[model samples]
Target: MNALVQKSTASLDALKRIHPLMPWFASFVLLLPLPLLALNDYQIYLLNVICIMIILATGLNIVKGFCGQVTVGHVALYAIGAYTSGVLSVKFGVPFWFCLPAAIAVTMLAGALVGIPSFRLEGAYLALATLGFAQSVEIYIRVTNYLGSASGLGGIAPPSIGNFVFYDYFRYYYLVMPFMLIAVYASFAILRSATGRAFMAVREDALSAAATGVNVRRYKLIAFMLSAVYAGLAGSLFAHMVPGYVHPNNFTVIEMVTLLLMVVLGGIGNIWGGIIGAILVTIIADLTRDFYFYQLLMFGLVIVGTVLFMPKGIGGIIDRYFVSKRFVAAREKTAEQKRAEAAAAKSGES
Candidate 1:
C-alpha cells in the first residue's frame, strides 16, 4: 500500500511540473496577431463570432461544466447584459465602459436570485425551472418598450477612449480578446481553488459533500452567480462588438443550446475543451450558414455525431487516448517487474 501511494505521488509530482507552463503556453498563443494580419473582412467577422462564442462557453462551463448544474437559460442573462449595456449607453448616455460592469453586477444578482429557487430542485426539475425562468425573462424583454419592443434598439456607435477609436474589426478584435482572456483566466483560477474543489465535491455527490461540512447550497449559488456574471460579461462584449442596438431575439434558444453543446462537446470540467469546443462549433456552424435552410440540420447532425462517438466530448477522447495510454504502459511495466522479482525469489529458493 505504501509503495502504491508513493508511486501515485511521484506521478502527480510529474503532472505538477507541467502546470506552470500552461499559462505561459496560453499567453503565447493568445498574443498571435494572425487575425489582424491575414484575415479579410468576411473572415474577421467569422473570427469575431467564434471568439464571442468561446467566451460564452467558458461562462456556461462555470455552471454546467464545473458545478455539474445544467442551465438552459444562459442566453437570457447574456441578452440582459447586451440590452442593459445597449439601453444604458445608447438611450441613457452612459459610457460603454461604465455600463459593462453594471450589467455584470445586475445579471449576477439575477442569477443568484434564480439559483435560490432552481438550486433547491435537482436534475430535470432544476432544468425545467431554469427553462421557465429564461422564457419569462425573454417575454419581459419583448414586452418592455424601453428596449424598443419588437423593432429592437439600434444606432449604437463604436466606443472610444482618449482619441483612440474602435471603428473596425481589427480594433474590436483587441477589445474582445482581452475580455476573453480575463474570463478564461478567471475560470481557471476558480477551478484551482477551494471553491472549485467544493463544486467538484458537490457535483460528485451532494449528500457526501454535505456529510463533510461542505455548504452545498451556498457553493452552488456561488457557481450560479459566477456563471451569470460570465454570461453578462459576454453580453457586454457582444453589444459593444456590434456597437449598436440589441433585440429580444438576439438572445435566442439556439444560442443557449449552442453554448451548452460547446461546453459538453469540449469536455465538461475541462477549460481548454470549452474554449476549443466553442471555436470548433462556431467554425462549423458558420461554414454551413451559407446553406441557409440546411444550417440547422447540419448543426443537429454534428451534435448527435459528437455525442455518439465522443460522449465524453473531444477533451475526454484525447485524455483517454493520450494520457491514459501512458499511465497504462507504466502500470504494465511495474507489473512485469513484480512478476520478475517473484520468479527470481523462486529460483533462489530452489
Candidate 2:
C-alpha cells in the first residue's frame, strides 16, 4: 500500500517536471515539417492560414481566455494591422521589416483605446459593445479613402531579406511559423508569470483581484494591448502572404466572432488549446467549403456540439478524458490492493 502511494506520487512529480517543456517540443515537431516537407502550394497556403489564425487566436485568448474579457472586436485590431502594413508598403514604400513594428504598435494603441471605455460593461453587454466596435471599424474603413475606402490597399510586395524575396506560399509558411511559435511562447510565458496570475484572478473575480492589489484596469488594458499586438503581427504576416491584395471588408464582425469561436473551441485559458482548436476549426471550415450553404450550417452545429458536449473545448475534453482514465486506473489498482490485503488477513485469521 505504501509502495503504491509512493509510485503514484513519483508519477505525478514526473509529469510536473516535464510539463513545462512538453508544449515547446510539441510545437517545434508539429511546425518543423513546413521547411523540410515537400508540400504543394495549396497545402502550404492552408498551413499559412492555419499559422496566421493560430497567432490571432493566441492573442485573443489572452483577453478572452486568460483575462476573461469579452472582446468580440479583435479583428478590428487585425484590420488596423493589415491596413498599417498595407498602406505603408504600398504608398510609403516602407520595407516590410519597418512596417511590421509600426503595424503592431498602431494596433496595440487601438486596442488600448477600445479597452478603456468598452470595459465599463461586462458579460453580454460588453460582448455587444465589442461587436459594435468591430462594425464601426469596418464602417470607418469603407468611408475613409485614406484607408482605400473598402477597396483596401493593394500592390503590396513580399518581404525581402536583402534581395531575397519570399514570393511563394512555402516561403511565407517558413517565415510566419517562427512568429507564430514566438507569439505562442510569449502567450504561455505571460500566463505562467505573476502578471498572468493577476489576469486569471481578475477573470475569476475582478473585485477580489483588485482587493489583492492586482490593478485590474491596468492588467485588463495590458491584456487587450497584448492581444492586439498578436493580431497586428499576424495581419502583417498575412499581408506578406497575400502579397498584393487586402480588403477592409475581411475584418468584419463575423471575423471577430470566428476568432472568438476559435479561442472557445480551443479551450479558453489554455495556450495549446487555442492553437489546436484554431487548426482543427480552420481545417474543418476549409473542408466544409465543398458543402456551400450547408458548410456554414454544419460549422455552426459543430460549434454548438463542442460547447454542449465538450464544454471545455476539444482539447479540454481530451485532457479530462486522459486524466480521468489515469485516475480511474489508479483507484482501481488501489482498490484491488485493499481487497488483496483484506483476504490475506482473513486467511491468517482462519
Candidate 3:
C-alpha cells in the first residue's frame, strides 16, 4: 500500500517537474468529454450541479477548514451573487459578462460585512453573527417584490460568444468547467502560499499566530471574502445557465447544512477531499431525490459517523499512511546502522 502511494505520488511529482500544470491540463482534457459521455441531458445537468457544489464546498473549506471560522451564512453570499446577477440582467439590460463580475463584487462586499463580527467573535458567536446575516438576506429576498421575491427571478441571460450560446446543458457544461477547474486550481495554489499558511496557523491557534506577527482580524476577513468569491462565482454561473433564474428558496438553511455536509465529509482542510466530497454528495443527492424526507437525516448520520470514525476525513487516511511509511523507513535505517556498527565491533575484537 505504501509502495503504491509512493509510486503514485512520485509519478505526480514527476508530472509536475515536467510541467507544473500538466496534471491540470490532463484533468481538463479528461473532463472535456464528460458531457458527451453522460447518459442524458439530466446527467449533464447533474455534472453542472456538481461543479457548482465543488466551488461552494471549496469555498467553505477555505473558511471553515483552513481558517477555522464557523460560518453558516455562506449560502447567503451565494444568494446575493445569484440575485445580483439576476437583477442586473433583468432590470439593467446588462450582459452576463457584466453581471458575473458585478455579482462577485457585491458578494465580496457582503462577505466583508459578514466577516466583521468575526473580528470580535469566535466559535458559536461568530456563527450566529453570520447566520443572522444569512437569514436576513434570505428573508429580504423572499419578501421584496421588485427582487421577484416569491415568484423568483427569471429571464437571466445565458453567456454567449457572439454566435455561440450556452443554451443547452451540454453546451453550458463547457461554460462552467473552466471556472470550476480554475477554482480548484486556485484553491490548491492558495494552500501552498504564505497567506494559506497564515490561515492555517490561525486555524491551529489564533493566539499563537498573532504572537508570531500574524494579523488575525485581517486574515479572518480576507478568508471570508475569498470564500465569498467562490460562492459568488458559483451563483453567477448557476444564474446564467439555461433557464436562468434565481430563487430565495434555493438559498435556505437546508442548503447550508448540505454544503456543510460536503466539507465535513470531504475532510475540512483537504482540498482534494472537498472535490471528492462534492462529487460524491451531489451524485448521492440526485440518486436519493425520491427519499427527500430522509435526506437530512442521512446527511446528519454521515457527518456524525465521519467525525467519530474519521475525524481528518478520507484524505487524512492518505496523509497518515505516508507519515507512517516515512517513520517506519527511518526506524529501519537506524536499526540497520546499529547492526552494522555491532558487526564491525565484533570483527575488530575477534
Candidate 4:
C-alpha cells in the first residue's frame, strides 16, 4: 500500500512539474463534452445549476471557511446581484455584459456593509446581524413596487456576441463554466497570497492575528467583498440563464440555509470541499425532489452527522487519508534505507 501510494504521488508530482496548468486544462477539456453526453435539456440545466452553486459555495467558503465569519446572509447578496442584473437588463435596456459588472459592484458594496458588523461582533451575534440584513433585503424586495415585489422581474437578456446569443442551456454552460473556473482559480490564488494568510490568521485567532499586526478587520471586510464578487457573478449568470427572471423568494433564508449546508458539507475551510459539497448537494436535491418534506430533514441529519463524526468535512477526510498514506510511505522508505545501510556495514566488517 505504501509503495503504491508513493508511486501514485510521484506520478502526480511529475505531471504537475511537467505543466502546472495541465490538470486545469484537462479538466476543462473533459467538461466541454458533458452537455453532449447529457440525456436531455434537464440534465444540461442541472449541470448549469451545479456550476452556479459552485460559485456560491466557493464564496461562502471564503467568508465562513477562510475568514471564520459566521454569516447567513450571503444569499441576500446573491439576490441583490440577480435582481440588480435582472432589473437593469429588463427595465433599463442595459446589456447583460454591462449588468454583470454593475451587479458585482453593487453586491460588493452590500458585502462591505455586511462586514461592518463583523468588526464589532463575532459568532452568533455576527450571524444574527447578517441574517437580519438578509431578511431586510428580502422584505424590502417583497414590498418594493419598482423591484417587482411578488410578480418578480422577467425578460432579462442573455449574453450575446456578434449576434450569437447564449440563449440555451448548452450555450450558457460554456458561458458559466469559464467564469466558474476563473472564480475558483482566483480563490486559490488569493488563498496563497498575503491577504489570504491574513484571513486565515483572523480565522484561527483574531486576537493573535491583531497582535501580529494582521489588520483583522480589513481582512474580514476583504473576505466578505471577495465572496460577494463570487455571489454576484453567480447571480448574474443565473439571471441570464434560460427563463431569465429574478424573484424575492429565491433569495430567502431557505436559500441561505442551503448555501450553508454546501459549505459545511464541503468542509468549512476547504476549497475542494466546497466544490464537492455543492455538486453532491445539487445532485441529491435533484434526486429527492419528490421528497421535499424529508429533504430538509435529511440535510439536517447530514450536517449533524458530519459535525459529530467528521468535523473537518469530506475534504478534511480526504486530506487526512492522503497525508496518512504519505506518512506511512515515508516510514517504510526510511526503514528500508536503514536496513540497506546496516547490511552494507555488516558486509564491510565481514
Name the candidate, 1 or 3, with the larger TM-score value. Answer: 3
TM-score of each: 0.86, 0.86, 0.93, 0.96
Number of clashes found in candidate 3: 0
lDDT of 4 at 52: 99
lDDT by residue (230-272, candidate 2, tens digit) is: 9999888887676557887678755665676788788887787
Cα-based lDDT at residue 308, candidate 2: 84
How does residue 327 of candidate 1 score in lDDT? 87
Name the runs in model 3 displaced over 4 angstroms.
Answer: 1-7, 329-350
Q: Which lDDT tens digits does candidate 3 get at residues 146-174?
A: 99989899999889989899999999999
Identify the runs in model 1 with alpha carbons over 4 angstroms from their true place: 1-22, 25-30, 332-350
Candidate 1 C-alpha lDDT tens digits along 103-143: 89988988898788755788788888889888988888889
Position 50, candidate 4: lDDT: 96
TM-score, prediction 4? 0.96
lDDT of 1: 0.80
Per-candidate clashes, comma-separated: 0, 0, 0, 0
What are the Cα lDDT values of the candidates?
0.80, 0.83, 0.91, 0.91
